[model samples]
Target chain A: MGQEHILKSHDNELARLTDEIVRMGEIAIEQLREAMVALQRRDATSAESVIARDVDIDELERVVSEDVVQLALHGPMARDLREILAALRIASAIERVGDYAANVAKRSVALGFTPPPPQARGLGPLAEIAIEMLEQVLQAYRDRDADVAAAVRARDAELDALYTALFRELLTYMAEDPRMISSSIHLLFVAKNIERIGDHATNIAENIWYVVHGEAPRQERTKLDRTSGG
Target chain B: MGQEHILKSHDNELARLTDEIVRMGEIAIEQLREAMVALQRRDATSAESVIARDVDIDELERVVSEDVVQLALHGPMARDLREILAALRIASAIERVGDYAANVAKRSVALGFTPPPPQARGLGPLAEIAIEMLEQVLQAYRDRDADVAAAVRARDAELDALYTALFRELLTYMAEDPRMISSSIHLLFVAKNIERIGDHATNIAENIWYVVHGEAPRQERTKLDRTSGG
Candidate 1:
């Protein structure tokens, strides 16, 4: 093959890989949306569907892993090497995001068995923030814009603050009314799942920054979740 | 350099990579142990130490990533390629294990503010199983023993069952005594951190199986943690 042909094919492969990752991120976001809808509507059937779809994200992750191996064997330059590494790490982060979404769905199913508590209202805002972070980070990754990625990283503290507040609220609610304890516990985990999705989004943001700059992000991540300390 | 000398140097690099991973695993285990002890003693000072030391595992992971990149650039054979992939994944998994240990420590610091609940005793047994699984999986990784790795994988179900039991028990405790609600919630997260550590160990075990067999383990993992479903 001609040298031009080789470079063209490599670029095409890189484009395809990027497309697959973007598609995976979209599906993960869909899963989170469906999960939140399931939670809000108390629809176990929708929750089950969301859980079933998690495998799609996992399968895409496997495909991305194989493509990374192929690209590595082609012996690209250092910049491309960073791209390959970032792709691997970012795919893994997205996979975990899907898992957390499924976890939220699973908790929604459990929550369905009981009367929805007033505090369940708190989850909607939390999921909204997390989903926004996921969307923004995926866009930053696609654009290779470190500035947008940094913005996503900064937004994680907002998610953490919401989570901590919800956590304390659930504890007080459960303590006031023992009947809400079981369902509140499930909500607690659901909130935690969403918070962790935000963390994964932050992870993706950092990977994007690394791919663009060939170094870790300059600023340290500031975590505001104080439930553990409270 | 002679061809034989080049091969010898490649082998040495591989050896160094393996040694670095093993050391990382050891530090992760130590962190878990120290976190557990810190929880049992309700010593925030010791817990603080465990949290501070998590950076060590993160640093080791960065080193492993660079080494993997260097090894990949050397044009490894197919088997060595699998080893490189597995090493990258194993390092990431161990880093997460370290993070969970730190999380456990953070929760312990919070728990120290309250009177020690009886539920705290349950965490010790859970941590023991998680630590054992981590140690066994690291050994399997070092020896490249798929059977041992599979055995470690099987043990995760035990950890899940223990975690589920603890989950139910803590919930019941909180419901019966509203005063224990805050402390029980912290214990819930602590148990979760240990359970997640077990899951990371399973991840490492699967990576070892992949390194040895060049494929994912054939048996589907059975998750026994039904707290989400319950």
Candidate 2:
């Protein structure tokens, strides 16, 4: 192929790779949403379906990684190389998000067989914020917008606050009614899963920042103050 | 410089890179061990020290990454290229292990002020398994031994079992005494942090397999039977 044709093909391949990553991100979002819905409804079937879908996301991660390795063979320029590297990292983060979703789904399935506890209700809004963060970060990734990515990073603290609140709320329930301990523990774990999903979304945003700026963000992503129980 | 001299320098750089990764793994292991010790002793200072040491691990990751990128600048053959790519991933995993260690230490500080609960003692063995797994996986990476990596993967189930047992034990404690709930919750999170560290070691093992076999493991690393509570 002529050098011009080769360059054009390479560019097209990168674009296709980007498209694949976006698709993977969408599937990840779907997994999170489905897991939330499964928990809200206590639908074991839906939860199992969410669990199964994780394999697909895993396959997509492998595909993205192989494509990255193939692209690396071409010896792309530094900026392009950074994009490729970031894509690989983002794909892994997306896969972990999928795993967290699956873990949430597993808890839902277990919680499904039993009567739903009242504390399970808190998960709805928590999942909402996490899903929103994932959506914003994926969009930032597609547009290569570091501003949007930074905003997503800032928003994670909201999820963390919700998680801490839910943690305390569940503990109170378990304390007041020892009968509630088992189910409350499951709900706590589910909330943790959703909160970690937010963290993974933040991780994706960070990767996007790296892809765009060729470095980490200046401000450290704020961590939740868990110790003070504030 | 002659091509032979250039090749020799490349080999040396790769060796240096491997040495760096091994050192990173050692820091990761130390972090896990120290976090465990801090948890056992309820030493806030040591916990804070573990938190501080994470910066070193993060710096190591950045150094290894920059080296990988620089090494990539020279178009490497496929085997050498895979090694370089795996080194980047392995460093990231090591860094994540450090993060997990720091997280355990964070929870330790929170749990410190309270009277030491009986459940906190369970962490001793859990941390041991995790540290051993990390040590084995790092050795596998150094030797490129897929067999050793696979062995490490199997041993993770022991950690998972211990974690599950601890989960049940702590739940019982909280149920029996409402006053214990808060501390129990922190202990549960500490267990989880260590469990996740095991998972990260498995991740490192998987990377070793990828480096050697140029593909994923034949069987998926069996997830802990969290669903069945086995």
Candidate 3:
């Protein structure tokens, strides 16, 4: 094959590889959203589905990781190397997100027999925002859009605000009515996991910027500048 | 001064530096422990102390980082470089642990009332385990005992077990008493953060062994054995 043709084919292969990892990310988001919806509606069937289908997500994570390793052994070049490394990191985060969702779903199943509260706060909106954040960052990864990735990074604060509100509201409810404590605590955990998913979204956005540009994009700075062993 | 005298003084400086960092680690762990205890006991004084002393932990983290950076720049031998880097990572983790303690203290200050029953069950033991784990790991760091570090790694499972039991127990309490939702939820988060502190201690143990042995000493394996990146 001509050198240019060979290079073009190699890029395609890496793109396809990244696509698989992105699919895993998509499934993780879906599982999370469904888990939240299941809790909001107290739908056992949907919650069970999330629990049962988690194996597929786990398998995808395994396959994607193996593919990245295989590509690493071949001595990938600059862009190719960045693409695979980012995808590998993204998959691990996605799988962990999935595990968190499954934990939420199991809680949903367990709380079914409890004294149902008169009013349960819906987590659907929070889940929607989390999925949107994950989707946008993954799209940025696919297109190598630094601006879009940066926008995703900035959106993390909004997620944190929602999470804080959810916690406070849940607290108010529990304080007013001790009967709602058990299910409410589980719901709180599910919400916390969803918020952490937003953090993983930020991580992905940061990685996307890193892969597209050689430097870490401007971070919303932590006050502690850890100059360890500087 | 004689060359022998200069050499002895330099060794003393190194010893002093190590001792100073360990003392800093102790401060961070104390802050973390007492922050949780203050929340459990509703002692605002202890909690306030944590907020006031966070800057000192941050300052120490910076100093340790500078020392490590200077050592690295001077082109130390491979073993020395490993030890220096390990120390730097430990300093950074300790600083973050202090941040976690400060966060718990803030929550305690805001609470300003008796915690919900679910919180009492969930957070109290978790705080104890995390504080003790930090103590063990810091000892391993000072003693340079790989076996002790390995033992700390193994102790993580106990913390994980406590976390699981506490979470489930909190869930049961919440279900029985919905009024406890808000405080119970906050306590759950505090527990989760403390559980993560346990994980960070494991990380320190892992780094210590890696520094001493030049390879990560494995105990439990993670599923992500992919070829792409470490």
Best by DockQ: 1
Docking class of 1: medium
Q: Candidate 2 overall Cα lDDT vs. reference? A: 0.85
What DockQ would you assign to candidate 3?
Answer: 0.14
lDDT of each: 0.89, 0.85, 0.71
lDDT of 2 by residue, B107-135 (tens): 88888779878888888988889999998
Compared with the true structure, what per-residue lDDT tens digits does model 3 show for residues A83-154? 654676677678878977876777777766665444355566777888899999888888889999998888
Fnat per predicted structure, each in turn: 0.63, 0.26, 0.25
Tell me how large the interface RMSD of candidate 3 is: 12.9
Error of 3 at A220 (Å): 2.0
Worst 10 residues of 1 chain B by lDDT: B72-81
TM-score of chain B of each: 0.97, 0.95, 0.86
State residue A222's C-alpha deviation in candidate 1, in Å.
1.8
Q: Which ten residues in a row have the lowest lDDT in candidate 3 chain A?
A: A221-230
TM-score of each: 0.97, 0.95, 0.63
Would you list the rank order by TM-score, best first? Answer: 1, 2, 3
